[model samples]
Target: MTAKVSYLISKPVVTINKGTHSIDAAKKMAEHNIGSLIIMDNEKLIGIITERDIIRALGKGISLDLPVEEIGTTKNLITINENDSIYKAAELMAKNNIRHLIVTNNDGKLVGIISIRDLIRESHVLKALSVTSEQEWIGSD
Candidate 1:
């Protein structure tokens, strides 16, 4: 059986206001132990800022004090529905070359976020279970 993205929505959504500075956004992410923050404007989802965006900013010599929206992944925000299958999520991530995906509900409301790490952890569990089942079958044969 395939797992739904909802099964991995264990954490609360960490968000930052759009006008927030890069340094502040980074601080929020660090404080929450998250890799990305949903950028909002007046309680509306506007974009997202990730560790990669901050690093890119540093590489370009951009001031960290600048608003995160200036460097956030805004133009083409990649997102997935919470009810989607994990396999679909993985395909979307690979297709877009993204490490994180914003998870929303059928109504398009923000729900949670999923990362490559999350998918890998789930995969490890599934692999272990499969191996254990195979071992049991072989032993019983």
Candidate 2:
């Protein structure tokens, strides 16, 4: 059976308010061994912060005390619903060339996160299928 996004996404998402400091968010990411964190306010989706955001702040010499909103990428947050298939999620990742996606509930509340690593892990199963198909093709030929 094809895997689904829900199967791979990390739930009980660690989130932050946009007002929270980038350093604080970075600390949470490190503590959780996660690459990204959802930014929200009163249960509404707002933005996202990631390790990359923290790096960019360092590059700009921005203070660690600065709010994550000041360093986070605000535009083009790619989100997915829990019910969406992994196929669709993978397509979105390829289209956006992004490594992570924020998963949302039916009411659009942040629920979890999925990453390319999750999809690539699934590819191993698909690879096994491909090998089987290739062997079958060779035998037929």
Candidate 3:
């Protein structure tokens, strides 16, 4: 069976609104022990804020007091359908040179996200299952 990217999407996506301060976004990430947050405006998906984004902002001497919408990587955001295969998610990530992907439903509504880590973990699980099946088949011979 082909595993779907939806399987890796976590609910409620940990969002931050458009005008939130950059510092607050960093704090939210810290509080959630997560590396990223979905940026929203009036409940609409706008962009994404990640640990790297904050680190880059700070390194560039950007003020934390600025709105997260300004600091976030809002332009050219890459997204994927939640029902796509995990392999497709990984391929998209690779093609876009991104570590995270905003996941949407068939109606183009934000539902969740997929990350490189999720893909890695799923791949490991699939590899384990494949190895187990191979062992079983050999043992039956």
C-alpha local distance difference test of each model: 0.87, 0.81, 0.86
Runs in model 2 lying further than 4 Å from the true structure: 124-141
Better of 1 and 3 by lDDT: 1
Each prediction's TM-score against the native? 0.85, 0.79, 0.84
- Give the C-alpha miss distance for residue 92 in model 3, angstroms: 1.5
Best by TM-score: 1
Task: Return whichever of 1 and 2 wins on TM-score.
Answer: 1
lDDT digits (tens) for residues 36-106 of candidate 3: 89999887899999888899999999999999888888898898888887877877887878888899999
Per-residue lDDT, model 3, residue 30, is 97
Q: Where does the lowest 10-residue lDDT sum fall in candidate 1?
A: 123-132
Instruction: State the lDDT at 103 in candidate 1.
Output: 95
Clashes of each: 0, 0, 0
Ranked candidates (lDDT, high to low) = 1, 3, 2
Residue-level lDDT tens digits of model 1 in 36-117: 9999888678889999999999999999999989979888788899988887887798799999999989988889899988
Q: Identify the candidate with maximal lDDT.
A: 1
Q: Which has the better TM-score: candidate 1, or candidate 3?
A: 1
